[model samples]
Target: MHNPSSTQVKIVTADPSAIGLFGLAIVTLVASSQKLGLTDGLSLVIPWAIFLGAFAQLFACIHDAKHNNTFGMTAFGAYAFFWFATATSWMVKMGVFGSELAGAVDGKQLGFAFAGYLVFTLFMTIGAMETHKVLFFIFVLIDLLFIGLTFDAFGAPEAFHKLAAFAELGIALLSLYGCGAAVLNTHFGKVFLPVGRPFGIFKARS
Candidate 1:
């Protein structure tokens, strides 16, 4: 008689947050430039929106799923899709899909979408509180950005547009810092950059 022996194998994966943040940083930086009137036209912005914003975050989302990180996966996935949809909307407005579709464009429809994202981001901002101060503030900026976008879409004053532009620029700067922290901290095997500790308010029971 022989006794059976079992061996367990665990797969290790790198954290995808750095790349995800990098993607977010790049896209927001470029988009904010346009929103701030520093740049013109969506022609160049669409490619970056699709490639960096959509695909890169989507790549992070997949790896985060493999890591069983629900928060990272959901956050990256939702933002990835948001970029994808935004890109498509830009294309449609640009008449890439044909004149008829572009002619039917309604700013109010986009307003509704922005409003919905605002609602989604509010909950996500709450969730980010347990992550880190850097991430929490990033979410806060994103919330402000969406608020401005939602109001601007609905024909709000120019101030709201400026609000969105500045908020988006803030997001870009913070995300760049977060990306650097994620990479350097991991590479150095130490806290090379401090992202601040989580608030510890809503931690799940072990």
Candidate 2:
């Protein structure tokens, strides 16, 4: 009698960073427009915040987790939740969750939140140094963005708000470039766009 044998199958998934960057690009573009006074209200920004900012990055986080990419998972996951919370906060402030919640709003609380994210981004910026120049600069811009946001929330001068607006716009443009590099490089199986080499400061263990 012949015995039956079991076989295991391995699955491969595509890189998720492209989608995550694309999401970041779109949301920041929309939000930065509002910050720069090119747009009117949070009412329009909220939808893109929830859908593209939250959901798209969350999707990337999950897939990165599957790939055992701790860095990608953490970065995408954190930002995804950030957008989710931001969208909800906007809704509450807009009276979508009743006037009681909206009445309790405080700008300083947002300052504290931005401060915390600034710390987070600082360390992440260090990590990005080993990634690639494009990503490293993106993290640097994010650092500037959070710094400006924190100061602006705490009633700093108008210059900080302008700083935040310009930084956010920079992030949007760079992220779009990064997204394009991720996709085109993979699809064409060649370096379609140069993202620059990673800094050789930290080497992987053998």
Candidate 2 per-residue lDDT, tens place, 81-185, comes to 999999998999999999999999998999999999999999998888888889999999999999999999999999999999999999999999999999999
The regions of model 2 sitting more than 4 angstroms off are 1-6, 204-206
Against the reference, the lDDT scores of all candidates come to: 0.96, 0.96
Q: Candidate 2, TM-score vs. the true structure?
A: 0.95
TM-scores for all predictions: 0.96, 0.95
Whole-structure CA lDDT of model 2? 0.96
Q: Which run of 10 residues does model 2 get worst, by summed lDDT? A: 197-206
